[model samples]
Target: MQPFDAKPLSDGDEQLLAALLDGMEAGLCAFDRDGVITHWNSEAVRILGWSADDAVGRRGFSGWAARTADAHDVQTRLLGAMDAPGRQVHEFALLTKDGHRVLVRTQSAAVQGQDGRPAGVYCAFSEVHAQIDLERSIALSEALFDDASWGVVLIDADLRPAVVNAHAARLLRTGRDTLLGRPLGDLLEQGLEELETALQHVLAEGSPPVPSELWLSLRGDESAKRHCWRSGFVRLGSPLGEEPVPLGVGWLFLDVTEAKLAEQEGSLLRFRHNQLHRAGRTASECEDPVEAATTYLDFALAGFADHALVDLAGDDGRLVRAASTPEGSSGPCLPVPVGTIPVAYGAAHPVLQAVERIGTVRASFGALAAAEPASRARIDEWAAARRWPEGTVHGLSTVLRSRGRTLGAVTFLRGAGRRLFDRSDAAYAEDVAVRVAAALDLAQQLG
Candidate 1:
């Protein structure tokens, strides 16, 4: 019985009303005491295909009769509810304008006159399709959370946890229930600048938030550690009448800790390997023996080595440490005997032999194959034939020269620990040997 205000509502309220109607996902209609349609929303039109033009001045059942037989039943319920006490709800089958049958949940309330008598009926309806749809959606969402290899979390506008999937709960090393509705920043509980930055970025990009990557350091665990993730944001509804606020973000997280570690390790390996590769190529490019060895050594170190020595074959036919450090290291003294002095030469030794014997650039892991009979015999015979000092062992890649001819041979001893190298590492060493051989050949031809 309150006076109706004709004044216009704010754009925000109009938008809010539209949002409310849209949010209902329910078909709604209002009828006067005479059963004439006064208002009908889009959902009603969508379900019945009958708008205000079709039902405003006409009987509700007659116009919608083509849509459903249940229209008469709904009218009966409304008439009874108008005569009776309070509000009521009912479920019934409805036929759409397209001749499709659907289950609908309907609620109707009385609109009172100035005398407090029943004036009309305001009814609202919701299609029950979402009942089954929601259940299936929930099941699938749960499955995704449980089965996913990465972590997932749903947060509120205040960045509070509305839901934390199983994987995310485990990643944080906490229980799902315990973490729910708690502030995400609080849960992180660390002064991680990157994590803070990522969260801020997500919220700053409103509605359909952008995906972001971040590193997290979880605390209050048995052991604190770092975890990386790629996260995203999605908006969720408030209640019913409220404006669609900027809700929290959804995080789709991937654990990339292992991948990152692998990338770093690979980079280091490639750097060392490339040094050897470059050294060999440089040797081949320069034809002078001194120049080739010097160039090869330069490429070998590539600013990575603390020292280097290029031992060329001496006039006495003994493999001698001819080229020493550019930085003037006292080691690899001339005539000190290559057999006694040792350093990690990699596969250059065997590669040297291959190049010498085959008359082409060769490469092998000499120290790695030192246990093999072929390698052992070659090394022993070379050293014994020279009648060199007892400690001197032939480099696996040794540049042997007979009659002013420099044949390639290299002795690769492991530096300090004599670490056992893997295949990839060995392959890198062999590549260097090939380059050194090419250089030696070029040097001989040029001479």
Candidate 2:
């Protein structure tokens, strides 16, 4: 690079000045100290349909550009900027080439002479509506990044955060500057590929008409929860380029995890309630009380677990497996007489715990689920050691109690594909156990 050579305004410099002024987006005009127009750019011609030949050397818009009534006030404001310390702002109407009136907003500043004195005034103006539109855009941009309640983020073409608002920073649990230029995968423990796909799609196509619901897991948080975000995206493009150039994406989102969870809970509750109702009606049609118990268990297992067991507290305090849902080849509960063969459940077993406490006991395969590259053989061995099905990873055991007497226990088992049994599962299991126990109690009394 070479230093720019400074010289007095020769013909070459004058041509350079003309090119620079014509390239500007704003309409520009310059007036000498005597209020005679000395320069006019192509933008000024485009705005008011007056060419440089028609505008330059004209005296202060008194005849052509402005009506005679408004010319005096307009010229006074334009020339007054030469005496002002800073730019002067004014809005006035001017006449076009065909005598049409155009409202314009102008910014005028004094042009300094080589002798350090005010030599002329240069005015840059645009249509009033266009100026208002630009101002509104700037105001909206500021407000969204500062005062908006939701999270807003600007993503660059690299799919990394370029700018993050305060709410977005808070939601991400980091400082605004800390998130910048960081890959989204750093913040998301899961769904990184899905989110990146969505961003890439936005960069290629335009925004979708509706917002998307994304379930993401936050990394580095011990409690790793599935957080649902209701997100909206917009593809950003550069306005200066002749062709539309993709900048990035504007992402706005709100955490809707709690709401979605509540909705799922409500839907789940309704489903369980319907299952319970249908189970009772079906159990009523059973001829044998034991058959009624199996019917209820069948209804409960539909959406709850993969397998089930019904162990009745037998004579002499032993637990005999009365019935069970098939688990591959295992059926500790039998074709034998219902009370003859007792299941060999260890003392620390979930069923034993539920029976002793007269409450629910939930157990899961500890740490095995979290281990990377967990082996199917190991899972089988673990389940076999506990006398469970080959793939069982979670279990919920609840005591079957009716009329203040404990009859036995009902255990629901889940495989690795399902989430562990939670409190809501226990509550629903208890409800099923209550009905099963009542049917068993009636059978024992009749016997």
Query: What's the lDDT for residue 338 in model 2?
Result: 55
What does candidate 1's lDDT look like per residue over 1-447, in tens digits?
111222466778777766666455778777777676666678777777766466555566644533445677667787666887777888777666665667777788887776778878878877777556876989978786788776778776666677778888877878989988766655664445665555555666554345665666675543445565666655555555456555666666777778876786799678877766666566456546556655655555442333433555545544445444433332321212336443333443443444446432322224434333245456555544433222223222334334455554543432211223445444554555455555555555676
Candidate 1: regions farther than 4 A off? 1-25, 28-63, 66-123, 127-149, 156-162, 177-191, 207-217, 220-226, 235-244, 259-275, 286-447
- Model 2: how far is 327 from its true place, Å? 1.7
lDDT of all predictions:
0.57, 0.87
Q: Model 2: residues >4 Å from true position, as ranges?
A: 1-16, 98-100, 329-339, 367-382
Report the Cα lDDT for candidate 1: 0.57
Please report how far candidate 1 places residue 355 from its true position, in Å.
26
Q: What is the TM-score of each candidate against the true structure?
A: 0.47, 0.91
TM-score of 1: 0.47
Model 1, residue 447: displacement in angstroms? 18
